[model samples]
Target chain A: MKHACKRVSQLTSDSFERELSLTEKMQLKLHFAMCSLCRNYHQRLATMAGIFEQMREHDLNQDIQLPIEDKQRIQSVLEKEK
Target chain B: MVDKQMNPKLWLKEHGDYLFRYALSRLHDTELASDMVQETLLAAWRGHERFKGDSTLRTWLVGIMKHKIIDHIRKEIRHRDISDRLEHDPTSTYFSENGSWQDSPSAWRDNPEALWDNQEFRQVLQECLSHLPEKQRNVFEMRELTGDDSETICNAYDITPTHLHVLMHRARLALQTCLHKHWFGGHTKS
Candidate 1:
């Protein structure tokens, strides 16, 4: 059971990276049904994924400005290369 | 005729910030990101005559930037093994010897969606990400923010699938721990 908890946590993380096999999926479900701790951990992992998606969306609207000096510097460098 | 809209100066004014942010999010270094944007613009200018109108100017510029970012990362990872720098067994502290969680995750009082709406929460998320180790940060950003596939990431980083998984797992664990402490009002570990 202890090893199963470790595997469950690992599988939770793996779900985001790649597709899991049917056996992996079944094992995780079984573990979650019996372990409230693993269940909470799984929920938090899913929540974290959602939060990351929000961050990506937020980045799109983020006001990240390049400095005027850097812009001019780049222009000068480009001219030199031309 | 070269597109009159392809003026380099005008392009800089309009798309510089967006490109810089894109590079910054990926590279996480101000000077390096700036250099990348500069290189991207220079390449775009040089290749302007060949640029067909099928793609938007911004898309073309970003497309250039993505290749540049990939090239830079490839060169970087070739110098050393990124996994060597990782902290050993980062998740072990949270789990007991028996493989059960030593400290089970607590329910966050604040709704995550609501937190996303809060600008401060977003800022904290960035801070947490920045706090991650270099390789882990790179892997996480490439996978999550850039939306690169696992195969591409593994190939670019010169890591096996198992190595990639472990790095990502450690990165997520660290980020969650950081957010729980800093954003969710959990105890700050020393």
Candidate 2:
């Protein structure tokens, strides 16, 4: 009884990374049926994953450029190699 | 014969920005990211003679950079703050001894999806990410940003799937709490 909520929340997180077993699926649905807090927890996890996805896309365009000093330093290293 | 694409100058000129961003995403330090790109170019130069042209030059350079990034991650793990490593269990006190919620997650008044466009929300998210424990932050960022399959990351980090899941789960929980507090106005006691 004590382990029920914690385990359900963990399984909810697990659902993102891998396929949950039928048992897990049924267990989560059943728990979610009875517990709104657990439902909120699961929903929040999904929402958070969505936020990260958005951030990743944003990072693709927003990345900072290589510093001029670093570029000069890399060129010197290449010349030394030559 | 050196592939024209393999010329170190070409790499520096063309792929430098891409490589720097890639390393920066993983390392989260401007200096370290730049160092990795440079190191990757040097390694590629030394080893280009052995190149079989099995992959695109960019792919090959990324391959070298991946190794360098992983190597640095290993060192970073060793030097990670002792306190940060000691307790990343974001769930501590989240539940009672009975594993029941001491205080369960509360309703978020606004839809998080709708708030994605809010610049403040984005800033808050970044702040939450920085608050994560060093290793957990690295692993979470690697997993989220790269979109690489779990197996590849587990093998690279020498962590089992269960360990990976635990690290990711805890990190997400921490982020969720932080965002709820700062962005959503639901206070989470530190």
lDDT of each: 0.81, 0.79
Residue-level lDDT tens digits of model 1 in A1-82? 6567766787889988888999998988888888888887777778888877776676663777887889999988877866
lDDT of 2: 0.79
How many residue pairs clash (N, CA or C atoms closer than 3 angstroms) in each of the candidate models, in the order given? 0, 0
lDDT per residue as tens, model 2, B1-190: 4556668987898899999988887767899889999999999999988777888788989988888877776665556632234344566657888888876787665564566777767788788989997768877888886676787677656678988888887887788788877876643423
Q: Which stretches in model 2 have alpha-carbon errors above 4 Å?
A: A60-63, B79-90, B107-113, B146-148, B155-157, B186-190
Binned by DockQ into CAPRI classes (incorrect, acceptable, medium, high), candidate 1 is medium
Name the 10 consecutive residues with the lowest summed lDDT in model 2 chain B: B80-89
- Fraction of true interface contacts that also occur in model 1: 0.60
Best by TM-score: 2
**Every model's DockQ:** 0.61, 0.64
Error of 2 at A34 (Å): 2.3
Q: In DockQ terms, which candidate is top?
A: 2
| Candidate 1, residue A4: how far the Cα is off, in Å | 0.4
